[model samples]
Target: MRILAVLLMLTMLPVASAKEPYKAKPGVAGNITSVGSDTLGNLMTFWADRFKGHYPHVTFQIQASGSSTAPSALTEGTANVGPMSRELKESELNYFASTHGYEPTVLVVAIDAIALFADLHNPIEGLSLPQIDAIFSITRYCGGEQPLRFWHQLGLEGQWANKRIQLFGRNSVSGTYGLFKQKALCNGDFLPTVNEQPGSASVVQSVAYSDGALGYAGFGYKIAGVKTLPVSPGDGPYVKPSMVNIASGDYPLSRFLYLVVNKPPGQALPLLEQEFIRFILSEEGQKLVERDGFIPIPERLIRRQLNKIAGDV
Candidate 1:
């Protein structure tokens, strides 16, 4: 009870009290290793710190390389949890199942929008997905006629017109990179001119420093120097990546952040991983999602995720 009391006092997080508070169980001590998802790096740190609040003995080793690194780490038994901003690819899923002889347990922790950001100084309002393809993809696979190279091509006037539109983005290994390619670029290859950054924050930083730059990254990286652009699916009526729009599918670039655990069928999740997952689905955990500028999953979705790791915890 003392631990729970300390947690309540320490939780300055906002109320979304749909799911009950997670009651930390006994004997959950161990070093938990997590690998994957640069987009989820900070969120994983936040979760680890708060998780440690309950079990002071518990420690975490986190490696935020990219979502692609997650599967092999889990399959090799080197990591306890794999945080991914996107779903497991078929090959990854198959490999894990082939090695383990069972499918990995998946937990949906939060909702996130893959937002397109521009420099704060840019006055451009919104862009359609096809227009995005035209700007970022050399093939113009989304039915665009030609590459949009300058600010003038995007309808900016005065000094802005002559400014070249510099493109910044994540590298090939990133899930953000794959998803953006699939959705925004119509699964076409990125233009060779793109300046690929190592992480999402770097993409934001690159855009922040360039007056006519456009970049895409997780929406949670919003900062003073960059502004997230409202995006349209095809033609008109651009939708902002607001909580309401994301939940309603109006914002087309949304995804559920997932936690991949290798749990054999008819077996128990190791207690530490199990409890940490429970805490993530609890009221305090979802609050962290909102605190980090992402959308929280609804209580109903919370219950569904809880059921996946339920019997063991």
Candidate 2:
């Protein structure tokens, strides 16, 4: 299903505001540790700072290694919040379910799209899905007869023709890597030549400075020196990862970002965490989402998540 349509027509429009404000309770204080999703690092920080505004005594510690770290951190009780840019794998979900005797609560917090970034100098029109597969993967399982190693292969001419296609990507532990593998590469293995960056900023910066470089990163990372390529499924029109395109389901790569918590079935979370979550589902929390350059969750999904945590909250 399309990402936006699936999230209760998150495709509808921008979040004007939630139905109510976050009701901050008295003496809400604690340390909140968030682990995972380099893509969500800045966003988590934004939300944390907002939450702290209402509860000054609450401190926060956030780590953004990758989404793979979230399940372990949440399962081991090392983090109060585990933000992920993608859904958990079956193995990760099963492990948590077995260990906790219940599944972790997934909070759909925002929307984002993985952007295929190129150096500003590369004037290529767009890339087809199979071409993307050929550029990044070894197996070429997406109908690529051979690997794409040079710019001229994609129809660039003159000075661009002989330029090598430099590839940058997230490390193995990243949800970006997994999603790109699943969608663009057709689950094929990445080429060994892919320069694996430690975080999203590195990928965006690497592409910005390197000629003929292409990198995949969150759309929020788009800055002055890079270009976001319009990509297609080989037959469809090329679609840019714009907010309108994402919300309209015209952009194929748009996805939900989430915060996962270890709440037991039939149990309300601890007051501090519960209040924090309530705040996240509130109007102001989603404002932080837009501030961070990610799309806010739609109202119905917000209400659905709030109901999951507490009926009255």
What digit string (tens of lDDT, one per residue) describes model 1 on residues 1-313?
Answer: 4321222232333444458877888888999999999999999999999999999999999999999999999999999899998878889989998998887887778878899999887889999998999999988888987789998998999989999889999998888998899889888999899999999999999999887899999989988988899998888789998888875556889777889998877676778888999998888888888888888776656766777786543
Worst 10 residues of 1 by lDDT: 2-11
- Candidate 2 has an lDDT of 0.86
The true-versus-predicted C-alpha distance at residue 173 of model 1, in Å, is: 1.3
Clash statistics: count for each candidate: 0, 0
Clashing pairs in 2: none
Alpha carbon lDDT at 256, candidate 1:
75
Residue-level lDDT tens digits of model 2 in 40-77: 99988888888898999999999999999999999998
Instruction: Quote the positional error of residue 200 for candidate 2 in Å.
Output: 0.7
Residue pairs in collision within model 1: none
Residue 53, candidate 2: alpha-carbon lDDT? 88
RMSD (Å) of each candidate, 1 decimal: 7.0, 2.4
Candidate 2's TM-score: 0.94
